[model samples]
Target chain A: MAEAEGEMSSLLEEAAARRAAPGRALVRDAGLIVGAALDMAARFRRDGRLLAFGAGASAADAGHLAVEFTHPVIVGKRALPAISLANDASAVSGIAVSRGYGAVFSTQLRMLGRPEDIAVGFAVEDRCGDVLGAFAAARQLGMLTIALVDGALMDRTLVDGTLVDHVLDARSGDPRIAGEAHMTTYHLLWELVHVFLDDPAPLDGPGTAASGCAADATCVTCADTAVPVHVTELRPGGLALVDTGGGTEEVSVALIEARVGDTVLVHAGEAIAVLGGDAP
Target chain B: MTGALYPFAAAGGDTTREELVMSTAAKAAESVELRLRVLERLGPSLAACARAMATAFRAGGTLLAFGNGGSSTDAQSVAQLFLTPGRGGRRLPAISLTGDSALLTALANDVHFDVVFARQLTALGRRGDIALALSTSGGSANVLRGLEAARRAGLVTVGFAGSGGGRMAAERLADHLFVVPSSSVHRIQEAQATLCHVLWELVHQALAGAEAGGVQAGGEEASDGGLGAGGVGADGVGAGGA
Candidate 1:
């Protein structure tokens, strides 16, 4: 019994360790994730809805992502329009039967996707043909495309600004670990998108224009913008001292009711909303 | 070129990009911490549950999984994981009650949404089978109903819940309950996924132990070490030394 218990403990530890590396890898792509949220917010500002799809377990992820956006779990957060292409089994089966299985997501994308919408695809390991196809279709429709894929499967072509605007890799070969990392990735995406949307900053800033993806200059959109600041002290005159990653900055909090010890989304010296707080 | 690509660098004084990086890092750290905590807390219970599950599977029992919303999708993933696991893993008999959209909608529209899973359990569940339900809140009406039905039918009930197990913990609705001690729904679901995966691995391990010990059907005299002494045979067919 002692030996058995030891083995079980070791197994549990191994499982926990295996899931950690992929999650850590996501921290390296914070800039990319934040950028994606900015562009997703831009698309939503244009009355665009999010269309998410994937295969097998990833299909479930697609549903989870869609629900997170369409139904805000946190009170006071606005519900954004979103839909999961994998939710309707009847439609998926019909598309697979009529137009090969690889056409499932692509077919749905072509039918429902719009120029202003956002398309997020989930692909575990190398089983990403349908997701790749959907990205291709999304590109043709001028949609903002993002992909969450396994690190082993990400290659030059997928990240070369051709297929996906944002390619976040969950750096793990194990599909389960990759799925967990993907969950965290999308949660960040959901949270940061709200942060950007709440901010009144112009999406096409000087940095955006320099990236060669200005709204009027070109149709291309880049994902690398904005960050949240930690509020250290709330001043009396609608101002707060915020930790801006490097140093403290006194920013106007007139737009938001921010408290000390809260993370606030800042844009051009103004605090928009308190990050990860209850709606008050 | 560097400033252009990195908006934070181009924004002059705003160095909050580092904070953005830190935020992601913080969430990742939180996730790892929660997972480790769950493993440390539930390791023994997980092992015992896996043993029971292996015994039920050996006796030709299928796994019936159900949940709501994201948990509903997770239920489908659980079924899929068992039915088609990773390389070198054996295919197990499992079904997600949330797979059939038409049936689920019909049940919800015709009857109350609370009875969708319970009605399915009545039709598909049997004694000695396993019922796995996932709920972030642990107070979902339909999930409680499903557990009640599973208990009535003699199926081994397992529940994955969060936020102090909600009412499921209070009422003891599950034979083996794993509650992720968090109020964040996203974190709870992530930890639940890890728990499910670990349980799957342990079940495989238990099954392997059974195989190595030559514990086959119709051999009441055979003793496959202490692994077969879990006393999970409510049906009386697969009990050890029956």
Candidate 2:
């Protein structure tokens, strides 16, 4: 019993010490990136968009970040003019097999990217032809580029000609952070960029963005015309009911149904159900 | 209050050792306390990471999660927290690297284990993607290889590991390493899961706040776009290769 008590005490102390490690360094770097992101937003106001691409975990990051821009929880947000190059299956496969992986991002950038746009690459390091190609395209297009990399790969000169404006390096090699850290980095970036775009303070005057044409306090999706939508509660396998108010018309009930009070995305008067809820 | 509310108290409940009440209560308290401690230590780093993701997201990027075995489940958990909201709002875009069996099996069968993640990285990765990898030991060959791929691809590399940081800690593959400081897999996993959940909450709060204020993260509204069934607010089409 005494030994157990001592062990417990030691554990508690260790946990406390671990908890106290300062995060100011990480936060500061994050701040710089956020500032850069805000600049990107300002450029976007001039009709520019942000483009992201990656493979595997990196690919997942590209897709995940793209989603946050497209859909938000807060009421009255607008869809950002950004795209994830990794979200298209045919495009990626066709490019990968025909042109090789290096051209994947560059190919997309050539057709869609503009000088006002911002291009970002998420990698543990700053090598590889695909990453280089994308960066080169961004540079050639006179677009701003940023790289998120690990400390081991922090030498910005490797990319040449200031291709990367900011580098957030963790200086650690834990594989989990390969995913976990991203959740942290991008989440912060998303918030900081929003702050610049919205100027949350009502005292800051009007925001630059326009409002959507939805009926609810939280509706962010808008169309030129008000499409009628009928929402109904859906039950799948007699498990539970889901509300489909924010649902789009093409929402597939093959997995569930549309329901009232459910937040949904509507396009052309069809119920395109969002994931989560009752859909299997 | 119900009239019968005090029945148990009025009966002077017999708290006996045979009931295992004492040990159970003690254990629960200890668990809660340990969790609290872990959170306290990791709060700032975790919060900062979330903030970073929010920023990247507003700028248009992707979030990718990967892990092995139960840790793979952790990756899935991370993906779900963003892609699907348990309550309030809609989904966000996120993916678990372990979600597809065909991809995993094929990679393992056709290529070396070290290339599992790297190959995917080469095939799908580009600039501005976030590569998130999880490994309790921080020494999984595939995970290490994946992180290398992420780095080479210019993806933001992040990791979650245990012990004195293992190879993940010493090698610098991750831009951020959150170590559990313990060799016990159970304890490390528990803490990591908790960290992921907290991150989910933070991301939601930040994004929801931004959207409510009528601001766009990626220059778009926060509501209608998403990619997966997990509820990430993705737009047009589904997750592609890798």
Candidate 3:
């Protein structure tokens, strides 16, 4: 009661701070993330689907990311296959009751996922032990495993591990921040994967992504990015000379503000929006 | 390829000096505006929503929440935040309708998909309870049906919506509605988070005041306690509660 006077401001600040942790992390790992997404796009071209799962707060993340893929909010964007394993309440309880809480995610994957499909798991601390189990199951099936880990315990196992192909770390311990960061990371991944898929050169003309890794569907590659860069300057006619990881790329920022140094959301050939803001 | 990949045009890393400064500065601007807008225009509605929540909790009512996609996650977040509040706040009963996969899939499969939430409501809602619906577009069919169902079951309804509140505002749904006027979904969600947090705080604060004897109470039950007499059955899960 006595603390009510400043409670509003304090709470608002905490929310922003929580959002900031993941926001910054996603930006720093932009290149690595975009590369991982490019690999994911290639997988999708081979008719691979995405299966997302988590527990507690991260379960919501699984659902949110799944919906974004299954039903693209952006117009004309193709709907990719994605499923949230946590969407079915009865299946969850039955599995948790029969097997254990740690069995829900992996059990669903064992039933539904194929070797070509991708598994996205989110774990904050040790709260959701099944994320690891899901990864283990996905690995056994030779599916690509992408994990978003918040705490050191989960990170220690998932990062640089063979079981998970992609491990994105949020860098902060706040559970809320981890959840928020996971949202942005997935959103960014969704956008970039679309960008690569829309390009269609690799899938349409030559042997599809099903060729090299078709047997195991696990050979992934990450080139030094050609478009992942910061706009150095906005020239006339919606063009930007951006500093890429290795060199520079002249890109169109017609959709978003042609601002200098913004992390342009380059989808297909157009800069859809500046990262962290909605499409303009 | 969709045109040639944008050729790299700048030399050296943009990271050394300019990118970090400008990106951080520009990106944070919209969020700051979002915070300011919520802080300035959202206080009154948040107060009302909190008061409603406090009244419902006092009457031993449960808060039932529903939404779709990101809003669904937010709905669950709201429930989690309320049910297991950090600090020294009292634990309140709240349910995210989307959390139960079996019940949700069962309803969606058995009945019409749009009626999933509404069906849950019909089974569980009581007169003294509250239904909080979150939809960024504010026009999600399932959410609308759920609101109607809650109203029919004598529950108070509040909604978190975006961009002119969509049909929720147009159709005059929600006894209490807080609309994030922004068109950007990210900003809208951020603003909604602010409002939800503020509402949680305001309700906790009010409860603390009443519990501390700072506010005099009317000894008798607040009349119009809204059908609390014929509430949920002995199990409190209603007859058909799945």
Q: What local lDDT does model 1 show for residue A85?
A: 95
lDDT of 2 by residue, A1-280 (tens): 3543343344344434432221223433443444455545555554567788755445656765666566642345566766778657788879767876667777788788776677776654332336656666665655667666544454445333344555555443432243444444554555445544554221122111111112233332223233334445442211122233454322222223444444433432223454333332
For each candidate, C-alpha RMSD in Å? 15.2, 21.8, 14.8
lDDT of each: 0.76, 0.55, 0.66
Candidate 1 TM-score on chain B? 0.82
Please give the C-alpha DockQ score of model 1.
0.18
Q: After superposition, how far is residue B72 of candidate 3 from its true place, in Å?
A: 3.6
Candidate 1, residues B1-242, lDDT tens digits: the string is: 21322345335434354455576567767877887789889988999999899899889889999998778888988997887674566777899999787888899999999999999998999999999999999999999999999999999999999998988999999999999999889889989998998999898877777776786521122232211111111211111121
Give one digit per residue, the lDDT tens place, for model 3 in B116-187: 899999999999899999888888999999999999898889988999899988997899988988786766
Chain B TM-scores, listed for every candidate in order, come to 0.82, 0.75, 0.78
Scoring model 2 with DockQ, what do you get? 0.03
Ranking of predictions according to TM-score: 1, 3, 2
Candidate 3 on A1-70: residue-level lDDT in tens? Answer: 3455455446545555555545555556765565467668866865779999987667777888898899
Off by over 4 Å in 1: A1-4, A159-161, A202-280, B1-18, B216-242
